[model samples]
Each structure stands twice: as C-alpha cells, then as structure tokens.
Target: MLELFKIKKNHFVGIDFGTASIKVVELSYVDQKTILENYGFVELGLANRGNMKPTSLEQVLNDSLKKILAKMNIHNAPAFVSIPGFSGLVAIIELPSMPAEDLTKAIQFEAHKYIPSALDEIALSWEVVEKKEEQGEVKDNDNFISKLKLKNESDSKSGEKIKVLLVAAPKKDIEHYDRLVSGAGLEVKAIELETFSIARSLVGDEPGVFLIVDIGSRTTNLILVEKGLIQANRNIDAGGEEITSAIVDMLRISRSRAEVFKKEGKDILNSNESPLVVPVLDLIVGELHRVISAYKEKNKGSKLDAIILSGGTSKMVGIEEYFAHALGEEVRIGNPWRAIAVGSEMAPLTKALGASFAVALGLALRGVEDYKKK
Candidate 1:
C-alpha cells in the first residue's frame, strides 16, 4: 500500500531541469491563494546542446542548481522535482476491485504486463481513478437482509475486479533524482512525472479532450488529455535545437546567431526580404501534423477540443498563428503561471519561462489538503 504524505501550507520551491536551462519557482500559500513568491531561471552551460553523458549532465545540474539557489537565497525549503516524460512510464488500466490493502499487489501484478523492466527493478505507484460495483443491479432490488448478504459476497469477490491508473519509474532514475536534490541541500518533498504536471497546469479544471504540445530545447512532448486525465503521451526527438540548426544551415550563420534569428526573425524576414524560414517551419509543422493525425486515428470518434502550445520554443513570434493555420484547430500558447499572481512587469519573463515549468509548478502546488490529511 502507498502511504499518503500530508503536504502543509508552507513555502515550497519547484525546480525544473530542462536541457538548456533550469527554472525555479517559489510559491507561498497565504490567505487561500497560491502566490508566486519568486521565480528565476539559469542557463546550463554544459548541457545546452541537450546531449550529455549521465555523469556530465549530473555535474551540470549540480552546478546550475547551486547557482540558482544562491541567487534566489533558497537555503532551506521543501522542494518538488519532476522526472522528464522520456524517463518514466505511465498508464491507466482496469483492475478488479478489492480492499485497499490488496490493491497494491494487484497493481504490481498488472504493472509487470505493461512495464518492460522487471517488477523488482522499478518503483511502482498507483492512484484509484474510478470505482464501480460490478453486480449491484440485482442486489439493489433485493430485500435488506438478502442485499446485505450479497454485499458481503460482492466485497469478497471485488478482489478480482476494479480499475486504476498506474505510474511507474525505473528505480535507478528515481534514485538519481533523489540524490541530485539531496546533494543540492534541498529536501525532496515529492517527485512526480513531468507529463502529469503538464496535464494539471494546462488542463486545469476544464473538461475536454485537449492536446498539449511542449517543445523544449531537445525534445517535444505531445500529450493527449481528456477531462483532466492523460490518455496518451509521446516524446519526439526533435525540438527547438533542431529548428535552430536548420536555420543555421540555411543562413550559414553561427549557432548563437541562428538562435537569435530563430526567436526574432519574423520581423526581419518581413522587412529585410531575406531568405524566408518558411520551408524549415513547414517541415517542423508537417511533422507535428503527422503526430497529431496519428493520435487522432488512434483515438477515433474523439475530436480534439483545442491545441495548447507550450515550452520555450512556443514564445517565438507567429508560432501560435502558424500552428493554428496548419492544424486547422484553435491554438493557444500555454502560460503555466497564469493562475499565480506575479507583478505585471514580470509578464514577459513569465512568458519566456514557457510551458516547460508547468509540471514543476503543479508539483510545487501540491495542495495543503493533501498535507492536512497526513
């Protein structure tokens, strides 16, 4: 059985480790509102390219975290960190209902069927999403005595039938993050999958089937969420760097110059009469369309309600309009910090932080209700 931890209304920090940068959000819960205490980000000098050996990347994480912590004066705080979507496995399945005590064993057995690793090699966790009686119709019509007897039998047999959402992460990956945060002089209050965080921040309290596309420095995460539940998630190998590299090759510019152009080129492309970047964008958009089409085909009969574009790359000028035009769907840039109150002057910084921090923000916002029960 999974033990629930009580999360209190205390100051907490969320650190998002991305390929090119680290984003840190400090949140304070006061007067029933989750306030944005402070936020900051730092560029990773070593792994900016998104490819690094595990050990080298660990060093970069440590260094960048140290700098960010020092700059933010975050000496002691309960921290919540997230594992990248590419690093873990998440699935929703139906299982036989039983006493909460037996649910863990049942989930572990079911997890073995979906997880590629040995059961012992991964840390497994599950949450109950729905519960329903399988044979309550006949019992509902019975007399009180007979109904009571049927309920007893049903409870006993319920062991074989129930549904659940299971999430598993490789033990090594979990330990790596645990060590990383502990080494940084911060206590890890909770660790969550990145996709789950993105779902919470982007999907919010709305009820609909929406697709959230997060284009990060090294990878693009495409997730299909329905009614606040994640139906499917896919991580593509291409991201902002690929787009920038294309610009570098076409314009024969250095990587740094290419990155600058990638962000601010629409104005220059219009006025300077330079070789347009449309061909490259077309390729990127084409690939995105294929991914979306495949997702739609797999989920037939479900129309996508909207497309939410998030991540640092989405901040590029005209990207939202380009996606809206290409996909023939409503496209809105995701602002993870939209719910929190930050000063108006920091709006641009918040925009630049992008959808990449959605997960971290949600994880950090792990509510006081959760803590109160514990």
Candidate 2:
C-alpha cells in the first residue's frame, strides 16, 4: 500500500527478538517501493521456560537464529533489531528554551526521575514531539506552552516548551544483543524499541489515533499513538503464556498440548475451552478499556479511532470478534505486509503470520532508512 516512497536498497533485514520467538524479514527497496525478498522465523522455546537463566536463553536464541538463518539462506546482511517491549522506559518530558548541548544535558538530568537506576547505567534516546499549527488556525496554547528558537531539533519561535519522548535501555541488554548479532555474522545497523518499530511497519505515515495491542507469549504491550507518534505504552505480564497456563491447569494438558490447543482451537467461542479461557480474555478486555480510558482522560477525551491487534497470540480464533464486542471499537488484525510487496504464493503465509512479523518488518524499514542516511 505504501507505493509513494522513492528509495532503493539492495540489502536490508530486520530481526525481532521476542520472549517466545525470533522473527526475521529480508526486503529490498526498488522502483520506489518495498518488496519482500525473504523472511523466516523460529520459536525460541521460551514460552513455558519457567525460571530460565539469561545465559541459557542467550545460547538457545543463538542456536535458533543459526537454524532460521540457514533456512532462509541468509548470510551477512545489514540488520536492524527490536528491543523487548518491556525492557525499557519511555517517558514524555517537557523542556524549555535551551541550546542543543544544554538540551542534551537537561534530558540526562531529567531522565533520572523516570529511570529508576542511574542515568549512566543505560543508553538514552529522545525525540522532540513539537506541536505545530497549520495555516490560519491556531492550536490551543494550553498544551503548547511556547516554542524556542532551536538550532538542531526545531525552528519554532513562539517559545513553546517542547515535549520529548525519552527512551532508556540498560547497557548490559544492548551489549548482550551486540554479541548475539555479531555471533550470527550479521552487522548491527541499529536497535530500536519494538513498539516504535511496530508503528513504523504497520502505522507508517498514517496520521490517526491508534491503539495497538500486541499479545506476545510472555507479555501484552498496549501502545497509544496519535498523529503517527507514540503517546503512551505499557507492557503487562499477561499474555499467551497466561492463557496457556490456564488451559494446562483446567484442561490438565501438557504445555506443548496447551500451545497447540490455544493456537488451533476453533470452538473457543462455545466449546469446553470457553470455561477455561473466558476469564483471561475478559480480563484482558478490561485492561484494554482501562488503557484507553487513561489515554482519553489525559487528552481531553480524545477517542481511539481503532485497535490494531498484533503478535502471535493475536491470531487466536475469535480474538478479533471478542475484543471488538467488548471494546466497542473496530478491531482487526494488523497487516504488516501492507507496506511491502509479495506474490500470491506467499499470501496464505502472510495472512497467518503478518501480525507476528510486525516488529521484524518495522526493524527492516527503519534499518533501511538509517542505512540510506549513511
């Protein structure tokens, strides 16, 4: 659907390292568009790995990557990867008139208030979310305090206090990823937050209010986006694993069997599994309501236009209808493939795996952009 971009790249890949699986997508940009070249995925075997050590997880992840890389016939491509959704902190901090160097220092000083640990303990990134008015209409100045003459980030002159989205990730986590990517013989072009990557891949230049609920194996991430920028995001402990556990407990099935049932159960709406899975789904629906309500309250009852469902668990049967019925909004599975071109032969695979590959697609798109700038 994104046919207007005019850029070309020969080599680009995006890898998504999630709690339960690793997904990778290889794409090439040609003729002013993005087209799917190749893609692959492998389960990390972390779904039911209770009390798994970080070291062991790393080893297993590397092993899985080796297999998926071989399967895709991928060797040594510039790569962009995703950070676990829950691993970092994102905050909106306001800063007034200041020099470029001073703004950096101010962000560092203000970061401590949001990040629990020392500022030096993590890598920090921030972007200015400036509020701008078009042509003849003047936006409410309540939120637009004033704009300052900024040399580096902006050119506003009304002296508005700019809102910055701050992101901080632990240094050790990044180091671990660096070693992991290097071990696979791939160059690390960049690393980014999974939510932002999702926005880039699925929401790509769309100016609308959207709430994306990505139900992964270990966590469910709720992200609020307004006019193409992330407004608020939260990653909760509840996800597919919790539902699997419930099924395993009530159905008395093995973890592996629960996984299969959770994925393939067709009668989830009215079958025996309903008794076991309804409570969890209902609770998630309630949480969705709370997230939307909070965002609405913060933005003067700004309504959510739609909910974009993503991740593996979002593929569950009846999931869309269940959420749509409960949330009273349009709920549909996200099409990460919409940004790229694919043949009819891959249509079924895309239909089945589109949501799960969202982060990887986003990583590749962002990675491509970053690569061109170099």
Candidate 3:
C-alpha cells in the first residue's frame, strides 16, 4: 500500500500503474492555466495475467516507481494513484430524497447490496445528482440550505426525483495501495478508480453523450459518460499483451521482440500477420461491440454521441480507424493534456504521451485543489 504525505499544496504528481507500463505526471500551477512540469513512463518487465500473483507485481511496481521518479526528478510531492476496476466495485443507485446527513448512511447501506465484499471492510463515497422538484417543501437544514433554495426557485414540478451515482472500493484494496505508496516514500492524498479518472481526463466538461474505451495492457475498460456524469462502466479481460502474445506465437519470436513488433509495427509482414493480428484486433473490437450494444439496449432511448480511445494499447497503429470502421461512428484518440499547458517544442511527445497518462493526468488534476473547488 502507498502512504499519503501531509503537506501544503504546491505541486501534484499522478502515477498510473498498468500491466505493461507505469506512467507519472508532474504538474504545477501557472498564471491561469495548469502547466505541465514533467512527465515520463516506465515499461513493466512483466505483464499482468491470472497467472501473476499480487506480491510479485507489487515488487515490480515498487522498482518501477523508483526509476520513474528518479528520471523525472520528482521527489516528495503529493501523489495520486488509481486502483484498477477489477479490484473493486462501482455502481449507480437511486436513493430516496433525504438530508445530506443521511446520504452517507444510505450509500453505505446500498453498497453492501451491490459490492461483493463485507460492508464494514469497504471504503465508500458518493455525489448527489440534483433533479428538478415536482412537489416538496424546501427545508432549511444547514447542510442543504443552498440546494433547497435552488430547487425552490427552479421551474421543476413538485415531487420530481433525480438519480445519483455511488462509488465504492474495499478497504483491503485501499490499504494495499497505501502500503505500496508508503514503501515508495510518497504520500497518497486520495485513491481514485482508473475508470473515473479516465472519464475525467478524457471527457472533462464535454456535454452530450460519449463512451471512453481504455485499452490498457491487461484489461480493457469501457465507460459511458453523459453530461459529464458516468452512467455505465464495464471491464473486459483483454489488452495489449494479448496482441503481443499473438505476434509472439505467429512469428515464433521472443516476448521482447514481439513487444517491439507490436509497438513499432516492424517485421509484421515477415510474420503471419493477418492470421495473428487480425483476430486479436477483431476480438478487441468484438468485445467493445458487445459492451456498447448492451449499453444501448439498457439505455433504450439514449444514443452514444462519440467514442474516445485512451490507454497504452490504444496507441497501436490503425486502432482508431479500426474502431471507427467497426462502430460506424467517429472515434478519436483522447488527449489527456488538452486542458493543460505545455511547451510547443514538446507538443509532439505530449500528444504521444497523453493517451498513456489519461488516468495519471486525471489523478494529478484531482490534486489541483484550487481548480477543483471552482
């Protein structure tokens, strides 16, 4: 588990742990825009799979942190790390109108019904989604005075109800991340789930409806966001390593060599490219298709407006076109740094690095306390 450092806010560092690599981003406040201080990534020596144990992966994470921090000259800044979705649970639930004091209890009670872990062993948090009132008297409680006034002044009818999204994770998983950060000599101010972080960095204030497909090294996460709120999410058990493995088996090459081919698109023709690459790509697209179709079926009237791709594996050549072709929709690679300031000389590299740092950038964005309060 990672340790949290108590300090005054000046800079923030976001660290993302992926199956094939780890990314870190350092940011500082500038005039009106958030300036990018420094950013770098470390490739993991091992890839995550069902066969890999958590203990072995923890060591790799520790070593990777040491190298990433040293190379970027980052030491002792408040850090944010994201927990993988597979290790926790996230759900959206409808709760009856209640005082803010009772919301926490309501969320906890609801969590036990949705989360597989014991209620006492989980850490939880939730945000209220305000709905137009159809019929109800405005209460003057100290906790909700502002909300009551806003609701009363609105044109909504009495007794109308709104929906809220609740997110929870097991305490054991939180402790595990805390231990890792503490071991690495970094403070963990907050722990965010990767899906939420990706949504934050990719979607931001974008309106309407959009789906974010995060193709990581070991898992592919699908997130549906509407009006800046996460409406649905799912994680698939496939990622970049599958593509690499296919290349390795087809070309009869070392894992390291296959990884190079996967990234550089080198020696692809020499190998049985179509039989290997085509199927892996098709599998990824197929899973995405299923997830999207299910989302559409569940939503009924809602339609997906766009598709944004992020994560390390999303950098594969022709992937954007592949998704666009399969989904028959506009698919764009996400730029995590779109809202942050960067030097012109570094623009090209920043664009390349943005996709990989979606979660990390979102984590760092959280550490920007002043900006968030506004």
Candidate 4:
C-alpha cells in the first residue's frame, strides 16, 4: 500500500502492465459521474515475462504506451500503475496496540519477520485495517492475534490488538516503474499492488472475506480480502497459458486451438467430463484449499462467503460451475463496471473486456477518489 498522499489531478489514467499485455483506461467526470473516456491495450508477447532485460522491457512498454495513448487520444494525464504481484509482498499482521507514533516503529520491526529481503532493501508501507476486539470478542482471530501477547499483558485502553495490512516493494522495482512511466512521457502519480487494485474495483464495499482468483497469462494470483482490506496474497506458476499448453499437449493441438477449446469447448470441458483440464484446475484448487484452510483455522472455522474470479481466463463459459464444484463454494465472475459509472456507449466494451481490464480500471477509479479527497 502507498501512503495516503495529498496529490491532486484531473484526468485519471491507470496503466496495468502485465506479463502478456498492457491495459490502459482513461476516466473523466461527466455530470459528476465517472465516464470511460478512452481505453486501449497492446499485446507484448513474451517480453518481460520469463527472461528479458529490464532495459528491453522498459523500451517495449514505453513504445506500447505511446501507441495506446495516441489511439485513445489521451494526453497530459497523471497515471496510476500497478506493481506486479511477483515483485511485492502483502500481509496482515496483528500486534499489541499502542500510540500511532510507536505503532510505526513496531511495524517496521515486525516486517523483518515476514519480508524475505533485508529491511533496507525494500520500501515498506502500511495502514491500520482495523482495531480488533480484545480477547474473546465476536471476531474469530483466536489462533493468531491472541497469541501475540497475554490477555493481561497491557492496559485495556492502549493494549488492544491492532491488525494492519503491510505492503513491501523492492526499491529496484520502484525505480523500474519510474523509468518505465517517465520513458513513456507520463508522471507516475501512484503505484499499488495489482491484487489491491482488483479488489478495489470489483469487490468495492462488499462485506466479508472474499477469495479473489485472478488467473493471468503467466500466473494465478490468489488474494484474501477481509472486510474490504487486502489480507493475504499468494501466486502460483500455473495460469491461462499453462492451462492452454496442457490442453495442447493432451490433445495434440496448437496453442490457438487449445485456447479456443478451453473457452468454447463446453461439452468436452464440463466439470465431471473434462479429465484433461481437471488436473490443471485441481492444481490451482489445491493451493486455494491451503489458503482457505489456513484462513478458517485462524478465523475459528469460518468460511469464505464467495470466490470472485477476475482475469482473462476466468471468462471461460463453464469456469464458474467448474470451480464451484471443485471448491464446494459459490463462484462467480467479477464485474469491473460495478465501481464506475458507465454510459450506454461503452457497455459492450465493458462487458467484453471487464475481467481483463479490472486492474487498470480499478487504479483509475481509486486514483480519482483519492485525488478528490485532496
């Protein structure tokens, strides 16, 4: 999480730089309602994903940004971009509460416990998600928060447990985005984790804990959002491309045909009938089960309300039913338009690309709201 700042801007342009493609969304206020002014995307095949120099990826992204800007007729706007999930860390930590001043130092000391890099190697930011109730309250955090300290350890007024969402991004990663955005002739106004942006746009004010399954081109990002704050994020190497590759290998088909088969082959790909894609989906489900079980144990056997799937791969015709059957939970595709006001002219485009464009649209919407607060 970026610290809350006092920056102001007019137009909100969000650039979601992904492994396989870049999605840009430009938003403006019309009659005090956010309107989708322009949007565009560029597919940069296999450039920065696996093995590519930072400089080469920067050049490619810069060139792509220029083309997108020209095609959308957007210019002179402050931009909010997302840090890839693989390069950042987000976690929920609970500790004995104290003054705001002392809490900052305590959080820094605690960051070393979870962050892989040295304290000085990464930039750390955090915000208090909630001031949890003290021992034996309605909240189901008995397994962890209560263990941080004894119930009589501190005074009731000041020793209440506080839970915060911590975010860490490497300094080099920040510098990389600085160069990429500057090289594209846009000032970088804000940078946030991609999963956080997706939650903001799609989950909005929906209450309770939600498992966000963002299956991207190269990886599947699993995020747990509790009471609207990002609690935990986990990433796996399996994704849409890998699933397609599995299909291609199983059926001896081309990548294009495999992709089409995964999305359109309804009869052969049903939840029970599709043994070919079952292993791949189950691999993802196994990881999800780990997170779910951990969360339940930590939260006193509570279960997640629903699983919201967002990404290009989540749009498969039978994916919702498939995952629901596998996980035994309600599953549905997220709607990106739920966060912003969309006029009739952009309805079809919003529906077609909602899942894929979620991150970019979220950054823009959150940016505009944050700007308005200034």
Candidate 5:
C-alpha cells in the first residue's frame, strides 16, 4: 500500500485497472454523505487479456483512462488505485507479544517467509490487528497500563499473542500503477490492494466473517474477511476468461460471440451449455472451500457468516442461486453502492452495475473516509 498525498479534496476518483477492462468511479462527499458523481468503463477485449506485453498494456490503460476521464469531464482529481490481488500478498501472522521494536523486526522476518521477493524489492506494511490473552479474550492495545498488568500476570504461563495483518506488494507493481494514474492527469493519492478495497465497499461495518469471491477477467480473488479485515487471501488463475474459452471451444464459436453469449445467456449455469461454465465456477468454489477450511482450522470457534460474490462474471443470471446451492451457505451478490447516494437519473444503473464496480467504489470511499477523518 502507498500513501503519497494528503486528503484535500471533496471529490475523489477511484480507478480499478483490471485485466479485461478499466473501471473509474468519481464520488463527492458532502454533509457527511457520499454521493455518486460519475462513472466510466472501457472493456479490454477478453481475447487480448494475457497476450499483450507489459508496455503495450500500459499504453492501452493510459489511453483508456485518459479517454474515460475526458469523456466524464473529471480532471486533476486525487485518485486512489487498486493493485491486482494476484500481484500482492495479504497474510495474518500470530506471534508472542513483545516490545514494539521487537515486533517490527519479527514482522519483517516473517514477511520474508511469505514474500518471494527480497525485502528491498517489496513494499511491506503491517499493523497489529489484535492481541489475545491465554483465555482467548481480546486485549485492547490502547490501555497500556491494563495491558501491561495483564501481560505481567500471564508471563508465567503463556504470553499474550499478537495477530498482525501483513501486506506486501512489489515496488515495480506500485510504480507501474503510479505511472498509469499520473499519465492520465490524476495525482496518485494512495495505492491499495484490490482485496482491501473490495472489503471496504462491500463489507463495511458488517459483523461476522465473509468470503469475497471476486472473479475478474483473468483471475479470481478469494478473500476471507473477518469483521472487515482480511484474514486470508487466495487467487486462482481461472476466471471469466476461462469460462468464455470453455464456451468458445464447446460451442465452436468466436471469442467475441462467446463473450456476448456469456452475458446474455440467462440461467445458463443450469442449461445444457452449463457444462461450459460450471467447471470454472467449480474451480473457484473448490478454492473457496479450501480457504474456508484453512481459516476455520487456524481460528477455531469462528464461523463464516456469508459468501459475497462480486466482479463482472457475478452479474450472470441465476449465479446467486447456483452458488447458494453449491455452497449451502447464504450467498448473495454485493452491493457496493448501497451506502452511496444516487439520484433518480442514475438509479437505473444501480442494478446493472451491481457488484462490478466494487473495487473502484471502495477506492473512492477510502478518499471520503480520509477526508472525514481530517
């Protein structure tokens, strides 16, 4: 995560540069309410998802962002951007409580175990998510004297355990997104992982654990969020593109035609052509089960409240019903715009855009949250 500029604007922009398209959302905060101002999206052909080189992709995104901003008449706004889930790491580590200085060094050492790149190549960040005593009770970090007393009492037994949320992203990936926003004439206010943005917009202040299954064009991000905090994150290489390819190969149709068929085919998951798509969904579901099981095994006595589905592919008809049946859990599509105010003129778009703009909206909401804090 990168924080470069201070919050100084009421109107904020969020850009989600996905593999298949670029989504931009502009929001304005007024009178303690967040209102939707403008939004734009440009679809990058599914067939060209992984074929484009890095430099080519950069040029395409730069041009697309510039065109979208110019068309929407949004200029020079402070932008919050999201790095793809596959390009970053989110891990929850538990260690015996110690001094602040020792904790910092311990987290750095733990980061090396999870991050493949060297420490110098990665931009690492961490925070003490919570501290727990031997009896499984949470300890407040703010009450230093009380916490010290409790620690002293517990020193003879088991020390208090600190659970830290560790986040790491490559420096090059950060610089890549920074250049994308800067080239489009927007100041880079902050850069965060897509997982955090998705959680912020969809699961804000919601109690209980949620697994956010964000199926993008080329990858699926399986985020296990407990009380709006990311507990475990897993990304799969299969996504909408894989489903589209199955349709193309099974029906012997062109990629462009298959793309349209995917969005228009109502109840396709249960139809005869269901074979083409169920595999991809099943792949994601299989990963979901593994992630949930791992999280449960690690943190006993915790239950996953629900599964929230987001991303373009989630807009498919009957998807919610299909997932509910498959997982036997309360499955629903996320509404990122639920808390944002939209006028009658834009109300019609709420359902159509539904879960697709979650990352973008979450990024924009971060700016609003920061402004409110100031």
Candidate 6:
C-alpha cells in the first residue's frame, strides 16, 4: 500500500504511465502558484521501428524515461506516479464515529468485505472524510452525569457516523512502479491511483458533484467526485481502441490510418461514419448513465455539477457536444492546465494536448500542494 498523503518537496515530476503512452510533467510552486516547468511523452509502440525486434515493456519504458529526461534536462527530481484506476480500489466506507486509532482498526475490518485479496497482499491507505458527533448523557458512578455535545463539520442527515475514503493497491504493483522510477534515477515520492490524480487536477476545490469520464486507449475510467473527493469508481473494458477498430472496419482502413482519422474527424455524428462510431460511444454513455443514476440515488438532494471528459480519446472532435447532448449535463473537456501558469508560447500546445496530461498534471500538483504548506 502506498501513502495517501506524502509530500516533502516543491520541485517534483508527475509521471503517468498509460496504456498508449507515458506522460511526464514537471512542476514547481512559486508565489502561491503552480507553474508548469516541462512535459514530455513517448508512445508505447514507438520502440518497434521498422525491422527492429519488439522490445520488452520494461526495457521500452526504461529507455524512454532516460531519453525524455535527458531531452528535457531534468535530473534527480523526486517523482509522483499513477497506477491505472482499474488496478486497485477507491471506496468510501461508513461506520460509527470513533477516534482516529479506532477508525483504523474499523476500516481494516470493513476492508475485508470490499477487497477480495488477502489483506497482506494489499497496500491500504484511508482518510476520514467526515465525522458526526452524537448527543447523549452518561452517568458516572451515579454521582455525576455528563452531557455529550456534538459538532458537525460537514452537513449530514445521519447521526454519529464517520465517512472514510479507502484506497488500496497490490504491493506487487507498488514495487513494479517503484523499480521503474528508481531505475531511472528519480526518487519516488509517492504513488497514487490515477483516479485521485485526475480529480485533483481537473476538479480541484470546485464544489458540487463531478463525474470524470477518462477514456484511455485501453479502458474507460468513470469516477464520481464530490467536493474534490472520490465517492464512487467504475471501469469499462471499452475505450479508444474499440472506437478506432470501428472506424477501421467501417471504412476499410489500416489501424494507423484510423487513429489519424479519429483525431481529425469532426462532426462525425452527422457524417456517414456516424454509424461506425456512435454505438461504441453510446456503450460508454450507457455506463455513464448507470453510474450517475447510482450516485444520485445514494446521495439524494445532491445535483451533479458537470461531466468532465478526459484521456486521449476525449480529444476527438465534437466529443464535448456529444456527451453534453447524451448525458444532458454541462459536459466539457477538462482543462487540467487551467490551474497552472503557462507561458504564451506553450499555450497552443497545452490547448491541443488538453486533458490528455491530466493524471500527470495532477500528480505534479500534489507535490506543489505540499510545497505550499511549507
């Protein structure tokens, strides 16, 4: 299990190792602002050029990190890394109010119900989201009676309950990512689920509930966030690859060509190729509806503020409008760069890249947040 809250430095790098590519963002905190220092990425398939033998995933990642760091002139910076959302669990648990120490033991007992793996095989971290105090009277030795007072920091309808955010990942994954970064000569400051990283960068301190639909190359990660905390999480086996496959089958084009068209294609819903893409998009939309319904049912009176579209597939033209119409919410492409300061020259590239670097930006922002505390 990785530490949920670990921050010791201001200058840090966020590395997001995605299925399609590995993105790195370097950031620093200055004058109460998070400044974007540098960023780079390399596609996973780039290692096999021409007739070269296929490279091992680990070796490809190692070589790519060395080249990217050298090219960017970055050295010895501590790093925060992200594990895919599907690899672990992010759950909110409720229990009777108790001291932090007691809550820890209670959380462990509750974890056994959610996690199928043995506790020893998992790395676990949790945070108390909120606590409710109960009012009562207790007799002490029949000579004196004490009245219990309650303080509620957050609004709640229930009595004497504690809500906790539980995060866990396999220890094997922690070691694998640690080796990847340490082998590249960077100290690993922290490792967190990409779900939280995306939330930090995209949702920030914004109020209200937000559903972040991150459509990566291999899978789609759906996260329900409330007041910047994750409340629910779901993963779909479909993603951008399936969309590209639809295009390939419909238009009879090579996968390489379909990828290019997927990015360049605009108003595709109105085009003849709509049949090729709409079904796959709708599959994701269907799941989104289910997640939204479940959240709304669980949290009555809470309104969904917006739907944020992210990841590589989110760059598809007209996607914002598509989701807006489908979900009937204020759907927008998430601009993770909005929270950070950027140079005029980098604006165009940043806008083009958009939320594709969300996880990385959020990872680096985590370090910047700690620096501000100092």
Which candidate achieves the best TM-score against the true structure?
A: 5
TM-score for candidate 1: 0.78
Query: TM-scores for all candidates?
Result: 0.78, 0.85, 0.81, 0.86, 0.88, 0.86
Error of 1 at 346 (Å): 3.3
- Report the lDDT tens digits of candidate 4 across residue range 290-348: 99999998889687999999888887777788789888999989888775777788888
Model 6 lDDT per residue over 1-374, tens place: 66544543667899998878989999988778788888998887852433545346678878888888778766777798888888888887778776656666788899899899998787876656665343221111121111111123475454566776677777777778888888887888778788888888888778778999999988789988876667888888778888888888888999998888888866665355544555668988999899889888887987899999999888887788788878888998898998889988888998889899999998888777757666
lDDT of 3 at 205: 65
| lDDT (tens digit, per residue) of candidate 1 on 1-374 | 45344433377888777777888888877776667777888988653444667788888788888888889887677887777777777676777666665666677777788888887777676656555333221111111110000112123344465445566777777677778888987877777777776776777657787888888887777777767667667677668887788778778999999888887747433334554464545665677677678767976876788889887877777677777877788888887787787778877777666776776676666533234335
Order the numbered candidates by TM-score, best leading.
5, 6, 4, 2, 3, 1
User: Deviation in angstroms for 371 in model 2?
Assistant: 5.0
Better of 2 and 3 by lDDT: 2
Compared with the true structure, what per-residue lDDT tens digits does model 3 show for residues 140-245?
A: 1111111101122223233444455566666776777767776777777777788877887888768777888898887888887777777777777777777788
Q: Using lDDT as the measure, which candidate wins? A: 5
lDDT of 2 by residue, 15-41 (tens): 898877889999887776777888888
In candidate 5, the residue pairs with backbone N, CA or C atoms under 3 Å apart (3 or more residues apart, or in different chains) clash, namely none
Taken over the whole model, the C-alpha lDDT of each candidate is 0.69, 0.74, 0.72, 0.75, 0.79, 0.78
In model 1, the clashing pairs are 6-371, 7-371, 95-162, 96-160, 96-161, 96-162, 97-158, 97-161, 97-162, 311-355
Give the least accurate 10-residue stretch of model 3, judged by summed lDDT: 141-150
In order, how many clashes per candidate?
10, 5, 25, 0, 0, 1
Candidate 4 Cα errors over 4 Å, as ranges = 1-9, 47-49, 132-156, 265-268, 271-274
Superposition-based RMSD of candidate 1 using all C-alpha atoms, in angstroms? 9.2
Better candidate by lDDT, 3 or 6: 6
Clashing pairs in 4: none
